[model samples]
Target: MKGNETPRSTLWYFVVAHTFWKNVEVESFLSEYRFTIVIFPTMLKIYRGANGKYTLYDDGISLDYLQGDSVQTLIKWDDVAKKLSLEPASKQTATRTFQVELIPDGVTKRIQYSGRPVELKF
Candidate 1:
């Protein structure tokens, strides 16, 4: 990540017009996730179907880094982000981690938890 790039941590929110809910086409309320690079100016997201299957959304992120069940499989997150070079300082394997969370019913429709990349090493 660029040294000058101050990490931006903001929630990705969705505000339903309420009318959209009344529309017949609105058969359901969908579950979605937003993924942000935290430090880098990158954000990624995915959706969870009623069937529990996941569909990815393109938020200007390369499919390679967050291409898999990265959010669900948070164990190797550091490695994945590094592979994507989202963190230029990631040369040191297993160095840092980007925390991810999926929040539902949060005051608004939004991806939960946004902030600077916090290092959590056991």
Candidate 2:
């Protein structure tokens, strides 16, 4: 405990996925036969902050790709904001004061475990 430290409500984490590329491939089986396929891929970006906490900010596809319409598997930013507490942390003041408490690894681990039960099978 520092003398001039202010404890924060909850640390924020962000995770985001964006459409990076779309491609079509053509293949020839024989001299007179041909096949074509279309492919779309998304790129995921994650930032690991203090104590190994992950950040995921969603624009659109991550929610659908993760939980879909009817399932409640993954937690969204809105849900996180509602369920957990939040405090603003700026780059300037972060250096001077301990504005946030280090959430125990076990708690985050449980959250990560419970949030996404099913893995995307390829």
Candidate 3:
């Protein structure tokens, strides 16, 4: 309920990967009443599952921040891999998995969008 924290009702859960960039084994946590604060310079990746489930990956530069599904900030985004791109889902078919890393603008690097989960191999 704080100024920086988003509502817990909107978020179901979130996964975070901190410092362990080599073989990231992200941790998943159910959203709680308390606020999840993430420090600056952290990179966030939001993804949706194939069965229409939303997931948040908080790749912190130094800390973690869960429950940011309501984050609506304007920023540039680039596909993590050239082979993967974000596209609209067809009427009869769901979109494939893809990931787009947020490009930091020195202000905010978080964004809420529609994306599918890619393997956490990074």
Candidate 4:
């Protein structure tokens, strides 16, 4: 049910039943076991930046902690270039800026409701 889960097909279920119930009625026992699989939409995408930090998008936009955050989710990871955003923080300078943003809890607590970082999740 947690984020760190791998979806397994019927074959995997069968194999697992065999492993745990060797020399027993594994098939019928496993059939009795109910698996309520919940599927969540693929909301986030991560791209390894040239600078080495993993840039998180789509996922960050949904977090309550980020609701007041100024960091913009400019574009989908695939649609943009190999590098991230093409725009700068200011027109006068070429200071590189990432599209996504994260705010510290101290500031968020002073301003808004908080939720765990859904995007930065491993």
Q: What C-alpha lDDT values do all the predictions have?
A: 0.25, 0.23, 0.29, 0.24
Clashing pairs in 3: none
Clashes of 1: 1
Q: Give the per-residue lDDT of model 1 (tens digit) for 70-114.
A: 222122123222211122222222322332222231122212222
Residue-pair clash count for candidate 2: 7
- For candidate 3, give the lDDT: 0.29
- Tell me the deviation in Å of residue 100 in model 1: 1.3
- What is the lDDT for 3 in model 3? 52
**What lDDT, from 0 to 1, does candidate 1 have?**
0.25
Better of 1 and 2 by lDDT: 1
In model 1, which residue pairs have backbone atoms overlapping below 3 Å? 1-88
Model 2 TM-score (2 dp): 0.17
Using TM-score, rank the candidates from best to worst.
Answer: 3, 2, 1, 4
RMSD of 2: 21.0
Listing every candidate in turn, what is its Cα RMSD in Å to the true structure after a full C-alpha superposition? 16.8, 21.0, 14.3, 18.9
Of candidate 3, the 10-residue stretch with the lowest lDDT total is: 16-25
Backbone clashes per model, in order? 1, 7, 0, 0
Of the candidates shown, which would achieve the greatest lDDT relative to the real structure? 3
- What digit string (tens of lDDT, one per residue) describes model 3 on residues 1-122? 55544533222223322211111223333355653543222243433222122222332343323343222222222224312222222222222222334223222222223443223322
lDDT of 2 by residue, 40-80 (tens): 22221222231122222232324552442222222222222
